[model samples]
Target: MAFKFGSFDSICGQGALPVCPLLGTSQGIEPGCYSRNVDLGGTIIFQPGACFIHIIALIMTLIMVLHIRSKYTAVGRKEIALFFYVYAVIELLCLFLDSGIIPTAHVVYPWFTAVHVGFICSIFWILLANGFVGFQFAEDGTPMSLWSLRISAFVVWGVSFFVAIATFNGYASFSYTKPMGLFIVLLVFPIVCVAIYVVSQLILVIRTLDDRWVIGDILFGVGFFTVGAVVLFAFSVTVCDAVEHYIDGLFFFVLCMLLSVMMVYKYWDSITKEDLEFAVGDKGAVWEVKECVVPSSFPPSRLASLPPRLRVFEVVALYLLTRSVSLPPSLSVPCSHLRTPTSRRRTTSLRTEEPEDLSSEEWEETSTTAPNLLEETTEATLPRDRVKATEARAASKGSTTRTHRREVFGTKKERESLLGRIGFSFFDASLPLSFFL
Candidate 1:
């Protein structure tokens, strides 16, 4: 069998150069010797080798689409996934067209072939757009970028489809004999898109990426694409004759194209990294929040050893423990008392009281009696005078034992310091504390 390039209707029967199977406007392979035509009832299936490969290619394209979708944070992920989706559709049509599942003699074959050609052209245009996506020409995954890619691809596909349909149906100037428009749309246009895409991606990899190995993927992809094209168009006849029609360029071409597409995915994946901080993944956002640790006597190394939840609690506890206790502003302690440690103890003693057994209501009443207590200490009194007044009050109340204990230990006799208030034995006063602001 031989290959022909003109129109689907003009495809001649088998003699020397068998007419192309895909609408005759595009390049297609004839049935090889190894192609076993199966008869499922009355229908004859042709080109099993090419059909199987097309199926494999379609499966690979779908897998690549899924792979592209998985990289949610990758730059141009949405656009590139769209590219694979289009390619998968193209491969699906190729399966029907190239495999002879949809025979050229069928009326719908021309329409499917035209649409296939259009998709091939459009998918390449989308690839060129993807190259610019890495440069951040527009914010990727945004409506502007996605819509522009979609609309432009649609236009490319529409124009290519028109040319193919016109050529196949012999409408307008696109004759079946000379399909110059179809040639440009199906062949030359894709070459241009591929060339531009490769150049732009090379620039991106060189300028933006640190690892130069990613360039190898691009090179490999280009090489595979070139080889696939050369095999399909230039060496198809040679290979067919050499193998005695057991196999043809179509098989090698599909395999090579699959490898090329895989390489494209690898190249894209290598160049783009996921923006995990911003991009919402399938697992959703996993915010790792930690309380801001202020500088303190506890070194960061030690603090880091504690659980994240406990770090904040320990910091607060340490803050209250280390700070010096002071009188309330309303109490009006004398300046002299604040100046000396001994004077501070004496002044604190005047305000301090024993932690006696009291009901919750009594404690609340005592805590709320701020005005009466303030009035009692309006004027500054000597420490000796205050001690005498306290002792006399205690003697009258018949609590001389409590008053004696207060005089010995000052204000701290019955009061638990802030350190004890936390009720954790982890704190050690002997440990060295360092503070950082």
Candidate 2:
């Protein structure tokens, strides 16, 4: 179906209108409504560059999905990463449609509309994922942002629904009137909103926080480039009319991959370590805030601060573990608190023990665990001489523990959001990316 440039004349033959290319409409009509690249002898041909870029992105997307599934344990980060994976798949399908691998028939409209919604969902998830990250950056355990988080997504989805209706309507009446105006509107809205959210968060982090956090910020900034790619796509569709150009999807897949991978590395470095880290620096408990719980071994301190939604998650996870739910083998959590005083200890080759270590018995008696509220405290008095000898050491350790606990409970590094973590250093980041292959 040959649409007259800037007009919907349908000059040659408007038979099926089989494909909706992101940039332009497919060429030819009916059984031969081909021309992703060329419609020669009633057969569609695809440009190699466009086709393979999509293929490469699809491959990368799958690799990311597999790695996250096998490695990362944080349910929140995992869900976000999965959304990105699904986003890539949807884009790949759209690429297939644009490449004339899938016929753009009237029958395909319903399915295509669904695919479009999935694409929107990908954006929605990214928006929320970023929102959660931003919230964590500024306020660790505050409950006030709950309404804003929900309302913001609701608004975006609500607008997107109307836009989707308009889009379908526009395509339905494509022959009668060009939906170019509405098309431009739909394309611009989410792209701008997402781009703005990511970039603004990065800027806010950089302005307010220290240099250590810049690594995650840089990743978010890289993710923002996906927005630029969307802008280029808008220009291509509206001005260039490069219907066959799949660079938009290509850019999105790659950029988002960078963002999601960077996030996984920062939040759950344990999974990405051996292959990536030369030395996993223990920056003291107070410095590295606990983001999520590992199902295999929940850190006693980290368990106390489970995000509101995951309050019951720890219970369910324990149930699963007891039932022997198979998990990808990873290093066990430092259950130093769980060990009995008399248990013989062996250290792993990779992990280094903290300095100023005490006997398991001594550590347990001195340590503070989550309160049951019912258990009565039984105090053990040390020998006066022994106490005097170790009084300074115990006091110092207690102070640090309390400080770390306070940091976990809505204090210290409150301003250090995820973006600041991204800007740590390039060499630090390059390690993980090197193992990504």
Candidate 3:
């Protein structure tokens, strides 16, 4: 219906009561030729296309919010997530209100419409604040930033709600025929907020970044928003008639809006780089074992200082690296202390030697030596005489056995430090090393 511009007096057709766009009232716009409503039982559903699109938009907003939450280290993540949350709520209210599920005649229609309108204003306000957040004006996700954003948004919502309710009820200076306050708040305010947000973000991207690609995201978002607005406001009736009422501008509008929101997330994610290397909490663990586990030089006090579970982790780590889990007869020493070239060579020699070759005295000496392997193997340096004896004994075995031992032990480069070996093994293992680390 035609509304008199700033005129309170009744005058011809222009004085007709103005219909709120979301209230499902006739705006004197003619229905398309194919316009029809779905009737199930006694209930009638209106604008099914718009309703379905609203649901899709709501789901997409929720998904975008979840994606924002995943960026644990991204700047302004919390603020962006909050913006999507508000958008999701607005889309939910729009779905019910626009679909006739909550009929226009319902008693709570005006209140729901007020809330929906208020949220629309608040969401744009939040978006503008987010644009400022990119500049680090107040530290995006801090208590001060969040609290100020929330409080200001709430104030905007309260004021918008008051204006909407006042217009609907014709309270104060508001009138259905002349809703200046409602028009300014519902239409003009959102437009201003969006324009300011666009300009602020453009400045942020251009001034702070060397990558110019993000500019395309902002442009695409603006393009979609502009096309959607033109389609919904300027050509809704024409498009409805052209499409035979099967679908109208609202469907395309919601679709474009969803794309715009997705672009917003894309732009934010592109510019905000998360330091994945140092990221902690839900993103991933940042803990790293910088010190290598050198058994020969490892101090007893240091080993004792470690937590019990950490010691077990070191043992498991060594086992994974060597692909061997053999425990010495005495379990008093740490597992790393057992991994010595001398003990491995001695074991190889024992495996190749005949039991009959050792006399009674040699066997007794060997038995006494086996018990002290843990202590002797963990020494900083082996005695020269013991090394010569072991070498002589290894030589007594056939050359074939010595070659096999060399193959088994690998080159000195292959037998790297425990930490280096474990690093390669961790990646190749079936289970992720993150669980242990």
Candidate 4:
């Protein structure tokens, strides 16, 4: 069929060039090819979709470069560093070709076609590096595994480079030709590397379920990148044409931007507010009252040094006490110890013996018999001692009061203040105070 403007053949067969089946089948291929033809004087001569993809990839390259430059001194793997350097150079070259600054048709420029393919495949290598780096950081904030992946990715890209050179020189081209080389090196290798990296990261995250935010961030970043890569791959294949190509590129760009933002947010959120405030050297005043609250079986001091598991039990007991007047089952003890029958019998016998031993006149004269008079004489003779005793008792009471206040009120208040500053108010302050009382 003769070529038409919007028809697949017409767009792919611009500039009076022979129609290639590979080019013809690729979707979203038309706009880029058509645009390139218009740029090269109304005839399609080069693959526009491929050129556009490279240009976008070059932009991504610049972003990666800037990110690396911003964090150059950050401890990471050497292989990742090399990948960044090589990927940057390749992307720059691809940008030049896509911009049409490097003419491939000239015999003097016989290697330009091979160079273009090599650079195109290198974009995937960079993406793989990025994903691997993310996975490394997510697991332990280290980059050791990224280095290994980078080395493997480079080997894969190297093989594609030789294939690109051979194919462009009109050497034996198999059903697995330039595109296959590009797919294996750029698309397939990177996808596999990222998949492995992401899965490993997820396993680590699941194992360390203590940090939900980290897991969420990893999932967000990897999921976005995976979807974007899939869309880009579809564009690279013939399933998507000109308009779809631009759409895919835009989608990929958005996903990348979202991933970057998520990484930043996750890093900042990981730092607790107390740490942040301490870093700023802010020690604000705390308003609180303390009470003398002790554990049923042990002194409050004993509870402080208990192991984490025991501490958790103590906290639960305290919470239950605060919520209810009845002592928890864990604290319940027999009433016999509180009011012993033996002690009650001893008290009764003493009262009976004391009544028979005392006559009213002798009891009045005897120190033990006239209990009220004995108490009066003792008080009258030791007035100064009483004052000193009162002062000592007051001081001791004050110290005990402060200790109880801290145990009952200070900790909860401090925690509430912290949570409030961080914008979390799920637990009401009154609940803990009631428990302490």
Residue 235, model 3: lDDT of 63
Q: Between the candidate structures 1 and 2, which one is better when assessed by TM-score?
A: 1
Q: Candidate 4 lDDT, tens digit per residue, 1-437?
A: 35333233433333211112233343213332222232566544344544466556556656655554344234332434455566556546544544445554445343654554565456455544544443344442245465555566666556666765554354566232234443454445655756665675566556644676676666676667766554433332233355543232323433453453344234323421223332322355642212212223332233333343334433443434434544445433221111112222211000111232223443223222212222323333242443344345446767554443333223443423322222222123233222221
lDDT of 2 by residue, 151-249 (tens): 554565555544544444555444314545434334445556556655665665556556545556446544555554543333323322344442333
Pick the winner on lDDT between candidates 1 and 2: 1
Which candidate achieves the best TM-score against the true structure?
3
Q: Write the per-residue lDDT of candidate 3 for residues 1-437, one digit (tens) a residue.
A: 33344332212121111134322222321232213467778887777777778878877777778777877888998998888989889888877876678866666877888888799899999998998997777987899999999999999999999988877776788665566777688767888988998899888877888998998999999999988877765566667678787776666777788888888888988988878775656644443222223333223333343344444444456545434434332321233222222222111111111233333444334333323322332322333333344445457775554453333333333323212322333112444323343
Q: Between 1 and 4, whose lDDT is larger?
A: 1
Assess each prediction's global lDDT (C-alpha) against the native. 0.61, 0.40, 0.62, 0.41
Write the number of the candidate with greater TM-score, choosing between 3 and 4: 3
Clashes of 2: 16
* lDDT, candidate 1, 1-437, per-residue tens: 33344323322222111224433445443333233365767877655567688788887877778777877778788989998988888778877776566777788987888888889889899988988988887999999999999999999999999998897787887765576677678767888989999999888877877999988998999999999877766565567678777566777877788898899899888877878677666775532212221222222333334343334344444444334333334432222111111222321111232223433443333323322322333242443443455456567778874655344322341122311333323222332222110
lDDT of 1: 0.61
Span of ten consecutive residues with least summed lDDT in model 1: 333-342
Cα deviation at 246, candidate 3, in Å, is: 0.9
For each candidate, give its TM-score against the true structure.
0.62, 0.42, 0.64, 0.39
Q: Candidate 1 — which residues are off by over 4 angstroms?
A: 1-36, 40-42, 279-281, 284-437
Candidate 4 TM-score versus the reference: 0.39
